[model samples]
Target chain A: MGLNLEFMLSIIPELLSAMVITLQISILAVLLGIMGGLVVGSFRVIGPKWLKMLIQLLVDYIRGTPQIVHILIIYFALPRIGIILNAYWTGVVALTIIATGYEVEIVRTAIESIDKGQIEAGLAIGLLKRQILIFVLLPQAIRRIIPPLTNELTNIVKASAFLSVIAVNELTKISNKIIYETFYFFEVLILTALIYTVIITLLGMLSNFIEKRMFSTNSEANS
Target chain B: MDISFMIEIVPRLLRATWVTLQVSAISLMIGLVFGIVLGVLRVYGNRFIVWCTKGFVIVARGTPAAIQIYAAFFLLPRLGIRLPLFAVGVVALTFNTSGYQVEIVRAALESIDKGQIEAGLAIGLTRWKTMLYITLPQAVKRMMGPMTNEFANLIKASSALMLISLYELTKSGHAIIAATFKYAEVLVLVALFYFVLVQSLCKLSAYLENNVFNFGKTADPRNEFLN
Candidate 1:
């Protein structure tokens, strides 16, 4: 009851295996979210007027609501429409949707952050619009977006814990399981939080390092 | 998808929405006060205090908001302290909000021109007076946009209080879902309620950034982390 350091250490292996699930889901969501964000983000920028409005509404809905509500809706509502997914996939879908929402904005903002002259310069060089986006705009935009994209990545990792609400065997859910069995809420939850903090802190450091490197080289190129 | 059931549940959901607003409003106010202190400390406090502030922000932002709420709800009672469910919700949320708010304040304060602070000191103003008169006025204007986004983020996050069995809007939706087995309609309505609340905050943020705080300059769209 005082502090179960021994028990906390004992459960770490279990928690770590669950952490793998967390990593898997996060990595998967990041990939899909980035891809979806790139497509949807580009469409919002270059697509026709009506499609832009549609995508904007979708983005706003995803941004406005909570991730927990998203998971719950995907869990409960999908079956009514004949689209049944398990807890894990439901989590992926929800996290991806959330990530893509913010990522679209990141992408759009990053793309827009590039000066208008860059696009015109590409046109003057005889590059097609698609070619300009890929060979010209995106390479530059990727550098600018690294910070926000990394922030979104960390958010997806943290948000993965919400999947526990739907009985996914992730870190938080496993910690909840241990707490129920042993009532070591303090030790277990603290350790669980440490795992997340350590991961995210490292991520933050990495983002800073990358941003520094990218900008320094960018300035060097400018010079 | 029972239209009638969804319509009927609106009043019940609205009552719960009131709880959500109460919880978030209390937490946001508390968070703003603490956030300003911590933000200033991170900028101007001693080494120890700055390290402590950084550590707190990392932990608060790093962990899932739900876990923080769970710690308050589940761990406190284990430690032989008792509080009402509403207090727990607000305490957990304020902790979460203050974490992000610290970064916002820190950024805004850091953005103030160092020359102006020195200029104030050169003209015989004390450090606190310089900060109070010169730095804070400018920082407050910059803080408004990010702070509004944080408020919306807090409101959306308050929905996590349902995990602790706090009877807020989400719990209200769950109740209706259980009784009627109309998951889609009820949950959609629930999401819509949250959407409306958060969107209004978003609109207010835009208005402040563009009209109130613009000063004829194009607004910067850099604050994406909160959304």
Candidate 2:
């Protein structure tokens, strides 16, 4: 089949509109995931024994299962418990749940990587556990976590494609819609991939820049 | 809410577990074969082949597997190449895993010391013979841990099969949930199945770490830097 430049150009605007929804879902999910990760990560490390085990189990389950299945469970199953969310919210919630699981491990590892002496120093200074966690542990942990956290964000962006399965009108879903309408499957898919590649590439570059800056600064301070 | 309904669904889900295992096992085997070949090619092949292999790895690694499955399911049929849902899932996953596994296997091969290859050559072995006899055996040993992790990853990733309408474990759980509307209960069970599978793999990794990959015991200075 001959390429339809005009048709493709016209669909660009619709696809661009859908990109907004995709970005919105990714960004919101990442934010919720990061927040959830902090809570769960801290709980896993420093919370009560039972809570730590529960959070650890949650993280394992999330990491072990596929995002699509998690989405299906959240979207379809939640309604049985009287929690009826729209597709977009369902997508975000489910993605957040999965993301949080992975992110907790990232955060917990970051926290663990912080020098134990620093925590001891905080205790030596008469800082309470809460103060030490809030001021000292979190800052260092967050700094160490920037790289992995960025990676998790990129993963969430790619994973947001699963939202399309539930008809959330994200970029991939929109591309599917266009393909269904125009019957230009290759063009639509290639275009969709290009969009994703561009966005993810930019995010990757930005994260690398930040990682270098942080590490170099840290090294300079240490030296 | 109904325990009896979940109990009724268990037999069906257990039967569907066979499909999940089949897809994971077949895809893992195919992916490992392709991964090792591509990985070795990337290391030992000429420049053009290396570039082509790199390109394959990059594209496969860069995109989501779900999109790959969707593309395969929808696009291949347009070219009069119709693959069954299970075939599509396995092929998509094999392609996906090959990309990542190429890097893993390549890294393991590269980690082997150069002197071993030269020693084999000194013994009058041809390059290919030396590679097969000297390099691969050591590389395979080094790859044991990573390969185990990759197998676990394959099991987890096979959950993507559900998106393509393959009635794997996750899909089976969704099927049960559809009838019983016990989303939380069914998902928890599904999650437990995944946990048991992955945790067993993790235990296997730990065992390999302790018993086989004895670098842990040596306290080699490399461990300090690596840790």
Candidate 3:
């Protein structure tokens, strides 16, 4: 009934293995999100009128709902609509959709942050729209955007824990399995949480370091 | 997309929306109180309390809210800590939201100039008095904008309460879908409940951001989407 060291030791091995699935889903989701966000965000920022409106509407719809709702909808609702996604695809697709909403905002803001004069200079130098974006705006925006984008990546990692409810055998669900078997509820949950804390905090520290370095370099280059 | 089904489910969902808000509202008030305390402690308490509060935030931020909900709902009964469903929802959500709100408040407090406190002491104010009178009011005003954003997030997050068999808005939609087999229609309408709630929250956040910064000075538009 009390904290069992023996049970804790036994369950850790299982939890660590389950953590692989958690990382697998989160990393995959984030990668897909970045790619999707780059394309969609770029288009939304500078694309034609109708496409911008369409993506804007889609982003609003995605933004309004919670991540848990998205996972539930993807897993349950899609099958009825004659689309079947396996657990892996479901995790990737759903989390990517949510990630893209935030990532697009990050990218849009990053692009918008570039001074308008830089764009004018690029145009004056005979650069095309794409060349101006790629050559003039993106380099600066990438440095500024790293912190928020990393923050979103941490969000995806946390969101992976929700995938347990859909029986994804991620870290949280694996802990639930251990809890039922060992009745070490408190020990198991704490241990599971510690792993996530370590991962997310490391990412946060990395983002802070990047932001600080970028800030100093930007200031230096300006001077 | 199944308008008749939506019409039929609307009333039931609306009723559950109140239940959901009750959970969020109660938890948010409790969480805000806890947040204010923890926020101050993190900023000005002795090293131990500050460190302990960091541990609390670490746990809250690291795991999913569902895990907290599960521990509160399922494991506690086994631990001889029995609570009603509503109480459990409030406890779990409040615990989780406090972890976040404390960060918001602490950041607000940190942004204040340290020289102001030194100035207060020069004017014969005690350290506690300096904090209470000189620091907290400004922090709370700036806190309101981010606080509203967190409150809106809290409401949206309350949807996770569905897992523990509580009929909050998200769960209410599931109940309707389970009975009527109108999954798409019920979910669409359910999404509408959330959309309207979040949009209103954004408006409130914008209002607070504009009107609450400084001694009624406007916030910088460059940082408008910041939080």
Candidate 4:
């Protein structure tokens, strides 16, 4: 059968409402990811050799495997270890873990991107290491991190769709349910895909704008 | 928790890993061909052609791979073009891979020095000839690192196929868990399989970077470990 535009239009409200859950889970993950990433990523750079190595192994394990497996581990396997989480919490934990892994890398690189000369200047001015880190390094690093951090938001949004596998009732899950009932596969899916495209494309544009502004201001400050 | 159950599923898990690798490899190979064409068109085609390629990339990238897989699984039957689930997964995965690969290829192509193309033209090589003989060879080298990243991404993204019950690595884990309810044991093995597979690809790419593509240029530090 042909696409039913009327049927597709009818489901928009339901799908849009479910979009809230998608955003909620993604935002939670991104928030947790930033905080966790900042803490762990800093340790990765400046902590003891053992901490660095430990973080290395964590990053390798998380990055090397698929997120689906992580979901299974957190949602399914963790119960065996006596830690239980519902599907929503499981989705959040899984996405946060994924986000934090990348965020850790981003933070580490952002911190590294700060010019050593800047640190030396802080020292030349008699600033303590802590002061240099807090006053000089982090300020610059935060500016550098924002663009990639914004990019990561889009990644988290896309990753949230995986929650559908666990019946998380997010936008994709809602759409899948509708498709099953209506048999309007093309219409429902195309609309769902459109919603995702709009969300991601907007986030991507914002990232580009921020990158341009950050770099331009950076050059101006340097000059 | 069941050590014996985990041991029992090793053979089946290994077979599923084979499926995972096969799907990823086949999709990536096909994707490379389409990506090259789209990347070329994006770089050199008329406005209409460029717009089409850009639109394809946007939709392919913007939507989730799971949605794409579902669309393939569900919509293909309506067109009277039904395929097995395995083929459907590959179709969807290839479509997804080409979108990302197009960007890699485009970036590689654009990074080629303009002067070289001009020199080729000055020596009477057509624009197409220059692209074929000079630009492509150099671009191919530059694309290798990013392409390696894309393949790793494809392998991970292919896990979305588990949603379609394609009996890939992750799906196999789900199957075993269903049969035995030993989620912990089955999934650890599945994750371990994917971990080793992706790590080996990363290591292989590193070796290629060091030995073959060694221009003495360092790789991007940000992507060094993250990808």
Q: How close is candidate 4 to the true structure, as a TM-score?
A: 0.95
How does each model score on lDDT?
0.88, 0.80, 0.82, 0.88
Candidates arranged by DockQ, highest first: 4, 1, 3, 2
CA shift at B36, candidate 4, in angstroms? 0.6
DockQ leader: 4
- Give the top-scoring candidate (TM-score): 4
DockQ of every candidate structure: 0.58, 0.41, 0.50, 0.63
Which digits, one per residue and each the tens of the lDDT, describe model 1 over residues B1-227?
Answer: 68887888899999999999999999999999999999989998899999999999989999999889989998778768899999999989999999999999999999998999999999999988998899988998999999999989998898888788899998888877888788888898999999999989999998898898885765644322111
lDDT: worst 10-residue window of model 3 chain B: B218-227
Tens-digit lDDT string for candidate 2 (B1-227): 56776677778777777787788789888988998899899999999999999878767776777777777877778778887888888888888789888998899889999999999999999988888889998898888888788888888778777777799998888777677667877877787677788878877876786687775564221111001
Report the lDDT tens digits of candidate 4 across residue range B1-227: 68887888899999998999899999999999999999999998899999999999999999989889999999899889979888999999999999999999999999999999999999999989999999999999988877887889999999999988999999988988888887777877888898898888887777677678995765544232210
**Model 3, B1-227: lDDT tens per residue?**
78776787788989998998889888989999999999999999999999999989988876678778877877678878888898999989998899999999899999989998999999999988999999999788878888888878888788888878898999888888788776778778888888888878877787778764534655433232111
Q: Looking at every candidate separately, what fraction of the true A–B Cα contacts under 8 Å does it contain? A: 0.72, 0.46, 0.49, 0.78
Worst 10 residues of 2 chain A by lDDT: A214-223
Candidate 2 Cα misplacement greater than 4 A, ranges? A1-6, A80-82, A220-223, B114-131, B179-185, B217-227
Model 1 bad stretches (over 4 Å): A125-127, A220-223, B218-227
Candidate 2 yields a Cα-based lDDT of 0.80
Interface RMSD of each candidate, angstroms, one decimal: 4.7, 4.1, 3.7, 3.4
Candidate ranking under lDDT, highest first, comes to 1, 4, 3, 2
Candidate 4 lDDT at B125 equals 99
A21-46 in candidate 2: lDDT tens per residue? 98899889988989999988877777
Candidate 4 ranges beyond 4 A from true positions: A78-83, A124-130, A220-223, B217-227
* Candidate 1, A1-223: lDDT as tens digits: 6787899899999999999999889879988999999989877776667877888888999999988899888888677779888888888888888899999988888887787778888889998777888888888888887777777888999889889889989998999999999988898999999999988988888889988888888983222
Error of 4 at A199 (Å): 0.7
